[model samples]
Target: MRWPLTDAARVVAEARVRQGWSRVRAAWFPILQAAVAGSIAFAVGHSLLGHPYPFFAPVSAWIALGFTSDRPLRRVAELSVGVALGVGLGDLVVHVIGTGWWQVAVVLFASAVIARFIDRGAMLTTQAGVQAIVIVGLPALGASGGPLGRWTDALVGGAVALAVAVLTPSDPRRRTRAMARVGVEELAGVLRTLARGLAAGRPSDVEDALVRGRASQPTFDEWLDTATGARDLARVSPAARRHRDELTALVQAAVLSDRAMRNARVLTRRALPLLDPGPTEHDLHAVGATVVDIAAATDDLADSLATGRTPDRARARLVAAAQRLDPFVLAPDDWQVQSLVLLQRSLVVDLLEIAGVSPRDAREVLPPI
Candidate 1:
């Protein structure tokens, strides 16, 4: 009871805090880059370029650098082109039609429609409408110094943001590792909970384990997104090109982790009936022991990933645990026992593949039905 109410709550809290910290750390460089790029754009436009209002400049920079790991040149080009199209069309319409509520609506529609024809990006089209509204609503801003300063501001802002992206120090691998760590740790925690449930033959414990496994999906999603971003960054970033192998491995690990999580959910679902008090006490204990071994193997694999070592020992333990489950494998005569064994076998296969086993080879190592 104490373990369920106190220990479980504490573990969940700690995992969440750790995940939140990792996210903030991964985002630090991008946040800093955006701030610096925005300030530079504003200073150049307002103080140096002598424009009375350079609001669009910083806005463009922020839009260009919403996230730092994205393709810098592509984002810069998109933002600059979008801003120019909106401002230019808005200026033309408002200058002729005169400043009125209807004119603003007309310019926005025209800019959005024009941007859509030029590009398929939602960002581009959205910026087009927003910039149109700004230009139409503020006539003096469009007339400010620097001669079509708003249009030029967009170009300058984008260029500065691109420069910052190119020059800023970043490590996509760090983000990749952070994401993988969370994913693997979550899987390990689920295994540990399942181990406890099987040992106690407590339905409540299995229910807790199932809830935990189901709750882990968002963490797995974060892993996929982060690893994919890292892989993409490695493709275009010169400094990060050297880490392509590591990033790719992380991406694959994220995929494997997804399969493992889904399998775990199924395992949890199947395990519910197995926890009902039954006559096979000896076999239940054996299965519980094997599950704990698998949990240890899971933890070791996670540690190996963090340290960049081959998880040879953990891999061996995982395979051995599957074999160990053989004696405890009750026949389908007892559906609950058979279902739990089969699902456990599938989970082992996923864990093995994640540890570098081929699918065919991993399944061959499973206990006979």
Candidate 2:
């Protein structure tokens, strides 16, 4: 029992380490940007503004920039406004009312209400209240450059963050493409797992495929979000505008692939019951082989999307697989098998659309059941 528990612990630890590494890979660039922006902010506040401790300078810069390339210039401006408003109000309130429990409560309420009135953004209101509380809690001793010195430091930070955001060179499509590849690869894996399960008539394999598909939802969601962010960046950045059409196609692919993944999960779930009563005389090997073909097509589609290449090969393979999804011919007399085929047909249609096929063309590729 101890050995088993130790093994389980080791597996969990390794999985967590992998997740952490993946996050680091995805966020390293944004992290570097934030760090640079903060250092610059602190330098400007401390050197030019003559603030000895200019602590809020780096704080405001880091908060405004954050650790994601998805942030647009407008978002950075909004965050900066939030930080400045919070620090200014906090300093004013602390100077007037002095630091105390009641002062803290009063400043928080006033700052939050004022922030809400100024902007509808939640970050603005929350930051305002939080900064006001910080001001009231900290000692006012050793403060230089007057009561508004900290506020000035925050302004310097905000300005530095805005400058950094505008000057930074970024390819908006890169992250979106990476996320799309991850999503489509996971979808392919699910299909391949489902294929093996169906070919072997193993209910456990089908269950495993279903579990993997469900777990992949977050990846699909992230893909969609990254695509949306790319679109937003294209709207704002001149350099990214040229790729708007490509970004739009990627967004569509993300949506279609998410649907494909959902349909695959449903198909996997439905397949489990058919195989649950132990292996029957009905040979599912051919059906499984068809699923493997679809998985291969999905892999090709992922490669095309990731590399900015034409998906002609993927489309061709998907069209061939689509032609084979005829329930009436494939499953014949077995209604249960026929139902699974129909679900697979839907999944194939989604993949076809992701590969740049029109809805009508994608549907027309499938033989009527």
Candidate 3:
């Protein structure tokens, strides 16, 4: 019992460590940008603006920027407005009513109401209320300029954060492409797993494939989200506008891949029952070989998407595979095997569309029934 418990503990610990490392790798760049933005905001407020204690400057900058490249320009503008509104309201309340519990409530209410009136963004209202509360709670001492010194510091911070966000050189499509590759590769892995199961006539392997395909929803969702964000950024950022078409393509690909994965899961589920009764006389080997070919083509798609290259090779491979998906040629008598082939045809068509082939052309690539 002790050994089993210890092993489980070790496994959980390793998994958590891997998750932490992955997060670090994904967020290190955004974290570094936030750090630099905060430092710059503090320097501008304390040195140039002559604010002795402009702590809100860095706080405002960090809050505005957060830690993701997915922020749209409008979001940044909203955050800046929220911070400024909150600071201004907090300053007024502190001077007029004095800092107390009641003052905090009043400032929060005022900030929230004013922010909501200005914009409908939830972050704007939430940040306004939070900043107002902080300002009310903390005493404003050692101020150099005037009663509005902290308010000016907050403005400087927001401006610096906005400047940093705009001036940062970033390819909006990079993260989208990365996520696409991840989603496509996972889809390919499911196909490969299904192939292995079919080749071996193993119900357990098919079951595993179905489970994996189901668990892959989050990856596809993330890919879609990333592509959408890239498209939004392209629309707003002049530097990224040129990549809008490509980002749109990626978004479409993400959608098609998601459909392909769903079909694969269904195919795997259908194949599981046939294997449960043990191997039959059906030509599952041929079916398995076709799945393997599709998996190879999926790998090609992943490579093309990751490198932003034309998926010519992947398209050709999928077309060739599609031509071979004739149910009559592969399984003339077995309806079950033929059904699997039919599902594969739909999945291949989706992959072909993802590779830039139109739906009509993709369907034409398949042989007539």
Most TM-score-accurate candidate:
2
- lDDT tens string, model 3, 1-369? 022444445534543454345446666897889889999989998899888778878888888888866555677878988998898888888888889988888998889989989999999999899888877887767344688888898898899888987787567877788778778988898899899989998766676677667766777887898898889778878878999999999999999999999999999988887876745666699999999999999999999999999999999999999999999999989999999999999999999999999999999999999
Scored by lDDT, model 2 comes in at: 0.83
| Root-mean-square deviation of every model | 4.4, 4.0, 4.4
lDDT of 1 by residue, 1-369 (tens): 123566457656666776677678767768777888899998998898888777777878888787544444555667777876777776676667877899988888888888889888787888888888877888554466544677777767877877876676556676667667778888888878877887877767676776677667778888888788878877987777898887787788889988987888787777776656667542355556767888889888887766667779879998898775553344434555656677778888888887888899888887665
TM-scores for all candidates?
A: 0.78, 0.85, 0.84
> Candidate order by TM-score, highest to lowest?
2, 3, 1
lDDT of 1 at 73: 59
| Model 2 bad stretches (over 4 Å) | 1-22, 44-50, 105-122, 142-146, 232-242, 277-279
Please report the candidate that would top lDDT against the real structure: 3
Can you write out model 2's per-residue Cα lDDT over 211-257, one digit (the tens) per residue? Answer: 67776777788789889879977876877899998999999999999
Which pairs clash (backbone N, Cα, C closer than 3 Å) in model 1?
Answer: none
User: In candidate 3, how many Å is residue 226 off?
Assistant: 2.4
Model 1, residue 133: distance off in Å is: 3.3
* Candidate 3 structure lDDT: 0.85
Q: List the residue pairs that clash in candidate 3.
A: none
